[model samples]
Target chain A: MSRLAIHGRDLLLDRSARGPSWLVPSLEVSRGERIALCGPSGSGKSTLLSAFAGRLAARRGSLQVEGCELVGASEAVRRAHRLATMGQALQDAEMISYLSTVDNVLLPLRLAGRPVGAAQRARAHDLLARLGLSDRQHSRPSQLSHGERARVAIARALIAAPPLLLIDEPTASLDPASREAALDLLFSAEGTVVFATHDPGLIARVDRAFDASIWREP
Target chain B: MIVWHAAALACKGLAATPIRAVVVVFGLALAMGLPGMTVRTASHIEAVMVERAVRTPVLIAPRGSPFEVTLASLYFRGEAEPRVPFFVAAQAVTRGYGSAVPVLVGYRASGHPLVGTSADYFEARGLRPVQGRLPAVLGEVVVGAGLAAQAGIAVGDRLRSDRVRPYDLGTSQPVELRVVGVLGWSASPDDEVVHADLLTLRAIEGILHAHEPAGSEAAPGLGASVFLPVDLSPETLDRVHAHGALEELPVTAVLVFPPDDRRRDQALGDWADHPELQAVQPERVVSVLVELLVRVRDLLLAWSMIVSGCTLALIALVLALWRRLRERELALLRTLGASRSWIALLVAIEAGLLLGVALSLAAGFAWVAPVLLLGALG
Candidate 1:
């Protein structure tokens, strides 16, 4: 039921100090699938993820997630859909720092005003356990190793059962074995995943790949 | 469980910025504590004044200002005794009115002023002496609790009048007044006064009389001693005591214990007719002080409410901005399916928790401030 569909779109992201219209976009995504958005180092891989999460404006064309129109939605509704229906794992290390792993997993539920009961804890714990972090449930991201913290971030993004789990360069800091383990966990995720990474080995495992440079606007 | 999560979030956030938390708590305590202590002390004074008013049921003084007469006669708060027509007391009692006792309140024992009245002063208003017997003669004294403790005075100790004033400038009194009694605890205003009989008050007249200019003596009119008695009855007191004569000026004010309110009013009406006399109820004067105290408390309450509101507003504003800066945390919460309202609630809960701690600290400081003020005064 996670139809994380995207339609014709354009996006402008300042890739260099070069100019404001550095990267523009036209793109699409659908549910129960994994799309690896890839390009050379300066390509708009992360920008497409931001646009998919509705955190970035396309400047043209329509976009949607969990069957709801995302672009041009009210600021509140866009933020709501982004936090609630979409599971977003930032590739950047400067993610939410003050909260513990368990609290971080429950962030969307907290925003949704749902009771964070034993059931939610169990689900979050199982997700962390799958990421081989059963014992690190209460640790802060700062305390975890890069690989371990990336896995925890991925688990946190997926804990809410959102229609789309968006991950950005999750394997950038992972070692070979941990990177393969992270790929296995993502390839097996229940909902659709739209992730961007420079890793070619990681891409061969995904259901599909889109060269983000081809999707960019002129 | 939601509360637990909210508390966990607040603790994490506040723990990250301990300096901000400490400053907020410090500001709240200072804002709330100082004014509470000052207002509380003023309230205590008002309480004491109100208690004094009710406890002294009647007052007698020479007819001038009613409030001044009441204050001077009962509270030692103002000037000396006035010229009372001694014979008028006889008329008051004969007309089925109450018994009247005169109080001469301006003498001092060991530099602390004494209140002089009859044994009826203690009986009509039940005050017990803590030690030693009642004053048996002119030189005998009965000291109050405060007067005794403050001056280090005790029974049988002899004291001289330490008073040296321009009006009463003379050699210190040559009399040896014996402290025959010490009063028990009476936390009322009377605890601060030394008690003596009317004869002791008239004792001043004797010392001043002999010190008079040699040629200024008038008929040597029955030395001041002739006005005092060891065993005085109304009959013998009038017959032998010169000041109790038709001619001598009367004692300060007469406290009449009228048989009933009707007799009191009748006595009051009778006194009202005379140009030089008046009757007053301590109850009415006390009610006025009570009214004043209530007004003061209400005024303080309004100001305190304003301070409290400001403290809450500062707390709320700080928390709101802090939450805004912590949007990453809000995003994390939201990504976990937390609603906007839930995130706001966590922030609110954090504010309430900090407020609770701040209020407790301020209350503790407020309670301690009074003790510190009283200690400093002591």
Candidate 2:
């Protein structure tokens, strides 16, 4: 049996009819594969990524992630599975503004009620350093530049080394150098990657691409 | 381990908003501090009042409020009541029950009560001079330990009584008396008194006069002067006597000590029917006052508790608003796999840290307020 990270059959992308419908309803994501959901703005690329992360429930059809069926699972079970296996960076690069860069990276473990021992702290520091934020570890989100904040958010998502990573437009607002650096970090990350973006150049770097524009009514 | 991490995070979060945290902590401190200090001061006052009353067995005063008379005589609280004859002390002593010490509280020197009593007053109150000697002459006075230290007046220092109306021309002149001794601390109002003899008080009241020869013209009414010069010559002593028999002089109250329970009952029974006098057990009077104080303390405690509850509610409200404002942050935490319980625990820890700091500050304020207040008053 092939090990699949995401398996969907006739999965309705939106729970309400007010949103756009899916053009290609069947999809499969194999382990260690880099899949990009590409489309124009409002074409539902972020929505598909959110669905894969289990943030929104499918209106109908079968959906499974890492061999676990999520279509009818309880919210708690889905959340638990997401926390244990999935690392996600949303569009806003939502960082806890009051926390320092290192503390923000360690937030997932803290939220999981896991003991943040010296090893965990060192891991967080290493992640920040790898993201070119070693000197900015003690700085608050407000003190960091926009690119720096995006890097902090990415570092936070990957701190736990989840088996599956979900990133939403990770390099949309970054400059060319920062974008290349961010792409380098994302592709180098060890896991199954499903990211949402409209940048065709970024789409060419992934193993496979799913066009969300095909689902648009026009 | 999880709790500790959450607490550390909570502290960091609070440190991020230093001004808001300080405001919340200080609001809680005032909520707790004012009542804490009030209760402490009331407890101290009650203890001192009860101890003084227990040591003093009974009070004999002309018919009036027993509470007022007991306070005035035992605690030197100036209360105006009809004066009883000085012979009452001699009468009570002759009864062979126990000693009767006269207390005349009217004048004040340096804002401290000037108490005129016999030498037995010190013996009855178990007071001993820690410096110099007790007043042995009419022109001498003994200062309380606190009064001596506060006024910086030691043995041989001269103190003048404050006239009732300093600006009034017809009022008696202020009397100057020598401080012959300083009594030890008694932890009661007695430690704030200026102790003198009845003759000294009478002289200050201008009721004692010196006889002058018909040919002598020192001054017309000057012989009735209330001021006592530093030097008391033999002639001054001979002239300054009660205008009439000493027995006819008035006293404020007489502190009576019964030798035994039987004598106490006997004396109480003897004065039970007296139309113009009353013998009261001072402890009973003090207990009533203490009960009132206890009620007041309970009321204050209740108000403080209500204020504390309001403060807690306000904190919860603020936290709720804060939680709402941090929706994205919390949603991010949820996305990161934080359990709802963990979020709740983090909030609780934050509140606990804030309350702990506030209570510590309240305890400090409670400890310091009474000392500062009493010192300022003194």
Native contacts, share recovered per candidate: 0.39, 0.61
Candidate 1 wrongly placed segments (more than 4 Å): A1-28, A40-42, A93-98, A129-136, A139-151, A174-181, B1-57, B62-262, B265-378
TM-score of each: 0.62, 0.82
lDDT of candidate 1 over B83-174, digit per residue (tens): 77655556666777777767766666667777777787777667788899777656567887776786788887876544434264343343
Task: Evaluate every candidate with DockQ and list the scores.
Answer: 0.23, 0.51
The iRMS of model 2 comes to: 1.6
Best by DockQ: 2
Docking class of 2: medium
Worst 10 residues of 1 chain B by lDDT: B225-234
lDDT of 2 by residue, B101-212 (tens): 9888878876678989999999998899999999887778999988888878899888887775667645356777888999999777878889998888776766664545
Candidate 2 deviates by what RMSD?
4.6
TM-score top scorer: 2
